[model samples]
Target: MTSLTIIDLSNNRFSGPIPPNIGESIPNFLYSLLSNQITGIIPKSIGYMSHLEILDLSRNSLIGSIPSFISNYSYLYFLTLEKNNLSKTIPKSFG
Candidate 1:
C-alpha cells in the first residue's frame, strides 16, 4: 500500500506493543517482525521512519527500553533486537 517496500511478519503468535502509529501507518516500509510473539514497548513512533531500511525485532517476548527514537533511522541498514526480554540499558543511541 502506497508503494510499500517490504513487511514480513515473521513466525506467528504476535502479541502486544509495536503499534504506536507505526511511522504513520507504514511510511516507507522495510519492517520485519522477526520470530513473533511480540510483547510490550517498542513504540516511540519508530522515529517517524525516515525511509527505514531493515528493522527486525528478533526472537520475541519483547520488553522495555531501546527507544531513543530508534536513533532516527538515518536510513538504517539493519537493526535487530536480538533474543528479546529487553532490560534498561542499551539506548545511548546504540553507541
Candidate 2:
C-alpha cells in the first residue's frame, strides 16, 4: 500500500473526509477524486506528499480554506480544486 500511486476514484458516491493521512499513506502518486460526495476540509497532511505530480479533488463538498501547504508539491504540474468550498487566497508559495 505504501508504494501505491495514481489513485482515481472519480464519478462515484464516496462520502467522507478524505482518509486523514492520505499524504503519508501514499507518499508518491497522482491522486484524483473528482465529482464525488466527499465532504469536509482538505487535509493539511497532503503537504507531505513531495512526489505528487497531479491532483484533482474538484466538484466535491470539500469546505474550509484551502490548505496553504498545497504549494509544497515542487514537482506538481497539474492540480484542480475547483467547484469546492475552498476559500482564502492561494498561498504565495504557489507561485
Residue-by-residue lDDT tens digits, candidate 1, 29-84: 58889998888878877778788888999999888778776776678878899999
Q: What C-alpha lDDT values do all the predictions have?
A: 0.81, 0.86
Residue-level lDDT tens digits of model 2 in 1-95: 77687789999889999878877767766989999989998887788888889989999989998788788778889989999988957878896
Q: Tell me the deviation in Å of residue 28 in model 1.
A: 12
Q: Quick one: best TM-score, which candidate?
A: 2
lDDT at 83, model 2: 94
Off by over 4 Å in 1: 1-7, 14-29, 38-59, 62-73, 77-84
For model 2, the stretches where C-alpha displacement exceeds 4 angstroms are none
Per-model TM-score versus the true fold:
0.31, 0.91
